[model samples]
Target: MRGVRGATTVEANCREDIFRRTTELVQAMAAENCIASEDIGAVIFSSTPDLDAAFPAAAAREMGWAEVPLFGTQEIASADGVARCIRVLILWNTDKGQGEIRHIYLHGAAVLRKDIAGN
Candidate 1:
């Protein structure tokens, strides 16, 4: 099996907002890319330090991703990164080529990478 990488980002007005938006973004990415929930090896999520209502991973579990390995951390401040936003990096086991993998950068976070987001 080959490994595939996908990323998604969403901005939230607050911690509670992050949980909602992040969950939506992840689910949308999985659906758009046709990612099997079981095929996901691991997921790494990072939120801006300002967000503290809850771990975004908790939202993932609520979305029925209980068995998927997940970890959450804080994102270091960067002039370019969005504030009060959540970003995700998902590593999945798949036979698809890298070019076929879909990376979702949504909401205000779309500005992070114009090249990819524009498409």
Candidate 2:
């Protein structure tokens, strides 16, 4: 098994914005890493405290991940943490080596992991 990480930021605390950004993040991670829903064991999402209009996992379900287990939580408050951020950790059953995995970070969240963001 391996893990894929992704993060994105939204402009506001609204259901539509949250869902759109979360879905975009997940889709990008899947496309970049060649991930299929069936290969996913679980997905865990964390959002900054300022974003509370929707659960990021719900966006995964809308994106046809009904069988994949999903969870969501609020990120711990930190003075330097980025605001309106949604982060995801996906557990996947794959034979690929850890170094081969691609991590995605979009929008303002890109600053959080410049090494793995691949620009």
Candidate 3:
């Protein structure tokens, strides 16, 4: 098993923005890891307190992940935490080693995982 991490930031707390950014983040993670919907055991998403317009999992469903186990949560409130951020942790059934997994961080969320963000 391997876990893929990804995160992205939105400009505002709107449904369209949330869906767009979350979709982009999830798609990037899948592409980078070469993951398929069937290989994904579960996906957990977290969003900063400021973002409450939509659940990130909704975007996954729109992307055709209807049967994949998905969950959503709120990030701990912090004064300096990234705003309008959505983070995802995908549990995948794969033989790949942890070091081989790719972690995606896009937009302003890249700063949250600078060491592994690759950009």
Candidate 4:
């Protein structure tokens, strides 16, 4: 199994923004890796402590990803860590090597993974 990492930031702490941004990040992760929901073993989401208006997993379920296992948690607070950030780790069943996997970081979260975000 391979881990497909992705992170995105919501402009505001609202349900609409959370859903939209989460969906965008997940879609990009799937598209970039050329995988479907069935190819995913599980999806884990972490939101910075400041973001609690909505759960990112709800956005995944709203995306018709009913069969995929989903979990959500709040990230440990850090003075220098990015805020209003949502991160996702998708456990996938694939033959792709670690170096070949694509990790997506969009919006403000891009600063968290500068090496792989814009690539």
Candidate 5:
């Protein structure tokens, strides 16, 4: 077995509208990476504290991922950190090697890490 990591971010117009968009972002990343809900070991998520519509993990649960391990936190505010945004680091199990793994930083988050986005 091997480990892989996937990441991504989504922007929300306001704190109240984050859940739907964030859910789309997470599900997109999982689908793009061909990750099975059961294959995901854990998912660590963060939202710019401004976002309070719901914990991004709540969206994951809405997607029918009850058995998956998940956690959520607030992203520290920085001059450069995107506002009203949600991000996640997915620790997954796969047979793929480190080089074969895909890390997804989508939506506005794409600009956050260009090096891996090309992959």
Candidate 6:
């Protein structure tokens, strides 16, 4: 299995905003990697301590990923880390090599990992 990573930031701690941005980040990662729901072993989501409006994984469910195993957790507080950010790690069952995997970082989260944040 390979891991595909993605991250995005929210402007506010509103449920709707979190859902929309998290969905966008997930969609971008899936589209860039050509990921299918069944090919996904599990999706792990994390957010900065500042965000508590909703779980990022809920956005995946809204995208019809009901069968995929999804989990969410709050990130340990970091003084220099991005705030209001949602991050995802998708353990994908695929033949793609580690170097072939594309990671996505959107919005202000791009600064978190400029090495892989083309999208």
Per-candidate Cα lDDT values, in order, are 0.75, 0.94, 0.94, 0.95, 0.72, 0.93
Q: How accurate is candidate 6 locally (lDDT)?
A: 0.93
Best by lDDT: 4
Q: TM-score winner among the candidates?
A: 4
lDDT of 1 by residue, 59-115 (tens): 888889989999999888887767767788888888888788777877777777678
| Reference-based lDDT, residue 71, model 5 | 93
lDDT of 2 by residue, 88-115 (tens): 9999999999999999999999999988
* Rank order (by lDDT, best first): 4, 2, 3, 6, 1, 5
Candidate 4 structure quality by residue, lDDT tens digits, 84-104: 999999999999999999999
The 10 consecutive residues of candidate 6 with the worst lDDT sum are: 110-119
Where model 1 places Cα greater than 4 Å from the true spot, the runs are 1-15
Residue 46 miss distance in model 1 (angstroms): 0.3
- The TM-score, computed over Cα atoms with residue i paired to residue i, of candidate 2 is 0.97
For candidate 3, report its TM-score: 0.97
TM-score of each: 0.86, 0.97, 0.97, 0.98, 0.82, 0.97
Q: For candidate 5, lDDT tens digit of each residue in 1-119?
A: 44443344545545335666767767767776788988888888887867776787887888898998899998898998866667777888887777776667666667777887645
Ten residues in sequence with the least summed lDDT for candidate 3: 110-119
Model 4 residue 21 distance off true place after TM-score fit, in angstroms = 0.3
Q: In each prediction, how many residue pairs overlap at the backbone (N, C-alpha, C within less than 3 A)?
A: 0, 0, 0, 0, 0, 0
What candidate 5 gets wrong by more than 4 Å, as runs, is 1-16
In candidate 5, the residue pairs with backbone N, CA or C atoms under 3 Å apart (3 or more residues apart, or in different chains) clash, namely: none
Cα miss at 58, model 4 (Å)? 0.4
**Worst window of 10 by summed lDDT in candidate 2:** 110-119
